[model samples]
Target: MLYWLIKHVLLGPVLRIFFRPEIEGKENIPAEGGVLLASNHLAVSDSFFLPLMVPRRVTFPAKIEYFTEPGIKGRLKKAFFTGVGQIPIDRSGASAAQAALDTGVRLLREGNLMGIYPEGTRSPDGRLYRGKTGIARIALQAGVPVVPIAMFGTDKANPIGSKMWRPTKIRIKVGEPLDFSRYSGLDGDRFIERSITDEIMYALMELSGQEYVDMYAAKAKEQAQPLPDRLPESRAS
Candidate 1:
């Protein structure tokens, strides 16, 4: 099968030999049923590397732009992402966020393992930012447990906005699954959402050893936006 070939034959050996990622607490992942692996996003590689180490097929909802384009280039890109098992969701507006969570809920309801970046965006300074309530909403509504995952040193392994990368030690720490069963009676209420997000962030803090900020990841990203982050200045600047 292509899955095994990619995991065990190709990417598996190459990643183990080159990056030398140190994965701890993998046992925290549930062996069966629907589970969420909520983590911090530090680099683009976070998406690929995290899933590679996991034994189960961990799926994430990638932006629809990954599949949308005109021509052969677009088709090839779409096929590649599809082959890797990433679900495409239109992330355009308020509805975009909702659609991702909606899709994730459906996957959970089907007893699948879903991976999400609670911080939402890569932390600009590597410090853990506040997680969005969306993660909590997904867990509570879907009635599944969330496992806190902390990925460290990935940005250094493949720093953002760089065309070249260096081999560096990467660490992935999977904390214990968080039980939101107490909110089983609350359903989709705001109170339960906040509680779930807080618990997830706390676990990430312990694992990643980063200072925690109380603001949402998006807001933190806005504050840390680079000069090129403007219409004029950019990473190339």
Candidate 2:
């Protein structure tokens, strides 16, 4: 009920009036099914714009921090995410990763559309990064089709760490469904998982036209970090 009210009666109408997102390849989305929407994460707005444009209710696993913040502000944030159909989960370490995967699989088994960022994190430089294999595991475990989606120009609308969103034009390019039925019951194969993940990343690269980086987005961000300042050298020491 909250999701419906927010998407249809409240925020959706306001966002559409301003952003006016252009959605292409709407035909690619299945009318009804347990499916995976694997997308390239570019900006914070990707979550909002993608859900707003899609006819079906899209759910993503958001960081538990969004739901656990303190005070009135935190309460509002939690309310908004819950209202928008997002599931809050821990995203810290290996165990958390597995937990998130389990959550996604359960959602799919229940016939819900699940949105995932295979890059594991947003592109630090607006380029596609190597995908994590969790998405493949979810698809294979749930026995669902993976639809590759590319969210364009969302970075311009809401750049990384930007609190305010601009009314910028954006496009959503949806690719055809990728079926991995043959890989069903083979989720334990790491090699097959990598193959599937790479294929999905390639589709995203083609759709978004972003340069592909072979490193994980989070690792790339770590590599791009600036080195700490060096202390001034003592004269003739």
Candidate 3:
């Protein structure tokens, strides 16, 4: 009820008016059944826009911090996220990856559309990064097809450090679902998981037309920061 209200009555109408988001190949999404939406992470708005455009309720795993903070502000934040249908998963500890995978598989098995970012984190430089294998693992375990979704212009609208969204044209391209039924029993195989993840990334690269970086986005972000002591290059010849 809250989800529908927010998507339709409250936030959705406002976003649609300003951004005027567009979508292509939306028919590729399955009409029914459990499926995984494997999307490239760009801006934070990727979560908001994708769900707004899709017909069904999309559930994404949010970091546990969003729900576990202290005070009244934290309580409100937790309530809002929970009301909007996000699952909280601890992104710390050794079991984090496995816990997330389990959450996705369970959602898929329950006939829900589970949205996942295979790249694990937002791209620091707007290029498609190598995908983590957890998405592939979930797909194989859930025995569902993976639909590749590419988001464009979201970074411009809601940039990495920006607090407010600007009115930028947003576009979404949905690629045909990739079926890995051939590898039905190969979920636990690391080699197969990597292969599947690579294939999904390839599809996203083609759809988004972004340069494919063979590194994880989180690592790229870490390497992109300049040292505090580094001096600016001299302009003097």
**Regions of candidate 3 where Cα sits further than 4 Å from its true position:** 228-237
Off by over 4 Å in 2: 231-237
Q: Could you give candidate 2's per-residue lDDT for residues 6-77 as a string of tens digits? A: 988899888888888889998999989898999999898888889988999999999999999999999999
Compose the digit string of candidate 1's lDDT tens values, residues 94-201. 988888889999999999999998888888778898888888888888989999898987899888788876788888989999888888867568777877788888
lDDT of 3: 0.92
Ranking by TM-score: 2, 3, 1
- Residue 119 in candidate 3, Cα distance off native in Å: 0.6
Worst 10 residues of 2 by lDDT: 13-22
Query: Who is ahead in TM-score, 1 or 3?
Result: 3
* Weakest ten-residue segment in model 3 by summed lDDT: 78-87
Candidate 1, residue 220: the lDDT equals 69
